[model samples]
Target: MNLKNLAAAALFAAGSALASLGVPHAAFAETTKLKVGYLPVGVYSYFWRAQDAGYFADENLEVELVPMAGGGQIIPALQSGALQFGISDALGVLNARKGGLPVTYVSFNFSQSSDNPVHAVLTTNPDIKSPKDLEGKAVATNLSYNTDWTMMREWLRKNDVDIDKVTFREIPFPDMLPALRNDTVAAVGAVEPFVTFGKEQGANVLGHYFTDVKSPVVLSGIVAMLPYVEENPDIVKGFVKAVNRAIEDFKADPAVARETIGAHTKIPATAIEAMNLGDWETEVPPSEMQFWVDAAEKEGILNETDDLNSLVWSPKE
Candidate 1:
């Protein structure tokens, strides 16, 4: 071989060696890293699926899914810039907004519909058969100001039970069953997986909350601080795309969703099989979100009417 040809071959070999060693090509760029927080519940089906499926990598994004106490409980972290994104309920997002925090819900992962309700008021005391019996009793909810809590409070009021008479306790979802079993709380607001597990633990199923709401109620969603979202609109869009794809993929095969749930939640296979899965939707429909806003205003959770359009980050194609 000629000297020039040998030199070319040697250069090619060096380049291939570098590429094999994961040295980025001249045009390659680092993936954007973002910290996302979730409640670590089985209901966060799509979030776990997206991570396991490499959807985030597909968008040149690296997501760090941090397990938080609860979605609503992580608002302060999100506001402090400690977290780039958080999964929260409509009530939490609105309450945060009303409290003067600039936050917005970006996408809906779970919603309460006629066919599928995400939360329920469960009681070990069969004597407290209905909401009317909740008066003077201690009821526990993971977040005092979240979607399920608001709906349960509203249900109590609408059922002729005075809200002030009921004692509201803040307890984590996992501890709710023990709280009820040990009589720490007379009734506990439980969501999927827990509700099924509570039943297994001999807790009486009172009723599913939001059963009578005429419109679909958003249960939980991806929330981000306004500044973070505004500064990274393209990143936010990519996130939504990955989440939406995950939702569709899960819908196409529900067993896969359940498996993802079990993997993240560590819930037993039997409980996961029996638990009712959430109605997962990616699009943020303004009309559906209005249900929570209206309820919040009427319940005095939000002092003023909220601008629905401003509170959601709907990405345009």
Candidate 2:
């Protein structure tokens, strides 16, 4: 073959090899602009910290932060395929899964669930003391039978208070304080941003329940629709890796949390110190989901999760 023909033949073979190897052509591109939902609160430091520091950008992820009233409502959005990803309390994910909401947690966001570590039980009437004091009284939470209720049950058990003795109500964290002032509920179980706000309103801090039974409760964590996961598997992997990076960033310098205050949550820089944002490790310990299963089961909230194992998923290490 002449030099010109030989060169053309070599170029054709090279192009064919590249195409057969599944490598994208120069024109091929990844889907851009992800729609990620988050509750309007300060404890979601990892999500905010990640966005603030451009960790998502570094990973080639362009996340659109969509704010919702609370993580509980994120289920419907996820179910209808309106959201690509979001952070949700573990209970929300479990309950939604049972309800066939088509979502699951990809990583642990808040590692601990003591009522006080990142949240609080508030009572405006200082006369009330202990979980037993909640008897015959109404209480409010941003969501019912989810985080606060789970936390309340743990606190009640810890304080030797009967869970059946109290009347529980649902109120948004923003509305919880107002409900407390209006006598809608005697006390309100609240977490971050709201915890600080509730306390500032002269609401007495009754008790804090971080874990279900003094065990780590995986409160708010990241979950995604399985279809979305299957559609963009790399997005899921990149997102999780980026979260670990964000957590490391926050763990090393908590100052970034202050910057996230206005964007992710309404709380100020001064309040960030008081709230406990656990270590930013991406691991969702298999033991963590146990806290939710045990708590929800014992509290009579496990209507759909009779078998704990069925409701749990441990990502491969």
Which candidate should be chosen as best, given lDDT against the real structure?
Answer: 1
lDDT of 1 at 6: 100
Q: 1-317, model 1: which lDDT tens digit per residue?
A: 99999998887777778889986453244588988988777677688888899898888889998888765568998988888888887888788887889888878667667677667788989788888888888988887767767877876776888989999998988799989888898998888888888888888877776665443566678899888888889999988889889999877988988889878777889988888776788776766777787888777787775677878777666
lDDT for residue 302 in candidate 1, whole number 0-100: 78
State which candidate has the highest TM-score.
1
Stretches of candidate 2 off by over 4 Å are 1-31, 113-116, 262-266, 303-317
Worst lDDT window (10 residues) for model 1?
22-31
Off by over 4 Å in 1: 1-29
Model 1 alpha-carbon miss at residue 15, Å: 15
The lDDT of each candidate is 0.80, 0.70
**Candidate 1 TM-score, C-alpha based:** 0.86
Question: TM-score per candidate, in order?
Answer: 0.86, 0.80
- lDDT, candidate 2, equals 0.70
